[model samples]
Target: MSPALTAEIAQRFAAIALGHVRREYPNKPGHVLAGPEDARTPRELHPIFYGSFDWHSCVHGYWMLAHLLQRFPQIEAAPAIRALFDAQLTPDNVEGECAYLAAPEARGFERPYGWGWLLKLSAELSLHTHHAWFDTLQPLADALVARFEDFLPIATYPVRVGTHFNTAFALRLAADYAEATGNGALFSLLCETALRWYGTDENCPAWGEPSGDDFLSSALVEAECMRRLMPQDDFLGWFDRFLPQIEAGQPETLFSPARVSDRSDGKIAHLDGLNLSRAWCWRALGKAIPEDDPRRSMMVAAAEAHLAAALPHVAGDYMGEHWLASFATLALEA
Candidate 1:
């Protein structure tokens, strides 16, 4: 990564952390005081349509903050980041338990967002160099893990086709936490389940018939999950079928028993960059494509274009989207 890019990301991280504490933290009238500062305020409570805690934003915040702290250790030499963390960490909010506080009377809704990401955040923060943060967050990480199994059956409700991406993300998180803590049993079980659910077969795609957005996310998610579990002959064979289409820029439809038109769902290219997804495929298949292969350059070009487009999104130290940091980090490495 160039020094300029690193510095740019560092500043973007600092800015978003500030935004989380400021614009994203205020509550409205007549709500119980869950905490002084939270993603869900009274006026701006999360819609139960997606469940509560709105934890994904918190996860994104922690991700951004951690990357910033790791790359620019001197930032923590100042006090604001720690202040933001402290403000977010309250007695009821610590670790994964924050999700529990979402009682019905208190207007709490159950979703994987709150606890899952916070657990991951606590685990990440436990390792931070800041002694005060390490002391506080390490125990939180351990506690969250201890309670993780209790929160099992994360998705009790029925899942729609597009929602597969969220489940896939959670499974990936499980794989990451398992890898971090050496708990293979849970990770393996989740991996196997995801593989079975999403894995392609002679009869159907792993997750069943999918439209454009569903196809994009399901493929991306399955490809990533397979990366963690390692390649199977079947997955490799199925992926090869799609590679040509993505390369051709007229990629055919996602998995379905009946092959559909390229313009399925109006030929919507639902997503932008496919670098992480493509990278996962490369890692899983354990076969490096030739540099001259159109797909390889296509992936690289997509990433570079994304980075260039993303740079302008930065404003006064804040990047507009959190995922851009991860993408930037990946692209710079590439």
Candidate 2:
């Protein structure tokens, strides 16, 4: 097992975050150009989230910083973290970000992925009680919430991929926000959608896995989403049927960590994330089961194995460095 999170690790992770959160180039801007004027720098396009490789990665990177700062308020990074929030989360900046979203050409801008993380960031900041970050960021976050309210009704089928398109991964984060903030309407919609999409899934084919750009496990993320949306008893029963072979580890792919041959190539780097996220799912799944369940051992072992595979590689390349820590933090916390 890994060591508990400490102030030192928290500061180091915060430093990694600060190093990239504002370094605006080598960027992957995921936007639609409505006119020639739209082709500006990342900062001009997104004043708050113009760093950390891409918009979603940057969004979650900020989430990581805020999460760590809140957890370890005495860490050296806390002051800088607060200052960054003060600077970037201004009403003008947030309104600018929202204006981009209101653009008619940008309906599917970040879709469920970035949209979910934006809410997660909002939820994280809300924990900072008297702080201005949450209220300042709420408008942008609400814009995404509105997008979700609009998007989920028409999104009858969940996107089952292992990347940004995966609807389950998005829903899991969105569920966190809905629950934390007591958004009854969104939470109900999420639960209903999750049950409708995955309640009947059984014997998921875990093989043919690890697509080149897969940072998610389609099977496991779906299980995670269901776990969030359903009651513990209902989730356990559904999980048993969904991955019926877990006790024996029959669908071995789910138990094995992915191998990353090239961390420098952005797409290949996703294998590292595949490993970390699998660990997150496994650890979470393990906790949801009983002390004596045979599958719990399998799940724990799988989580550790995946953690071991990916922990050392969380750095060393820009492609992976931009966002791998968020997943690593998720797995480590699990």
Identify the leading candidate in terms of lDDT: 2
| Global lDDT scores for all candidate models | 0.44, 0.89
RMSD of 2: 1.0
lDDT of 2 by residue, 231-333 (tens): 9999989998998888878788888888899999999999999999999999888999999999899898898899889988988899999899888888878
Which regions in candidate 2 have their CA more than 4 angstroms from the true location?
none
**Candidate 1's residue-wise lDDT over 1-334, tens digit each?**
3213465567665665555534433222224554565544432443211111133444556655765666676763236766766655544344333343434443323233334454555445645766455455554455445444544445343233433235554555556666665677666666666656555423323344344443224454555555555455555565565343556543333211222232222222222223233333333233335456666665444434444443443232222242334333433433
| Model 1 segments more than 4 A misplaced | 1-5, 22-54, 75-78, 86-110, 113-116, 131-165, 201-216, 231-238, 241-244, 250-294, 314-334
Please give the range of 10 consecutive residues that has the lowest summed lDDT in model 2: 1-10
Per-residue lDDT, model 1, residue 105, is 46
Candidate 2, residue 263: how far the Cα is off, in Å: 0.6
Clashes of each: 3, 0
User: Clashes in model 1: which pairs?
Assistant: 28-43, 102-108, 198-206
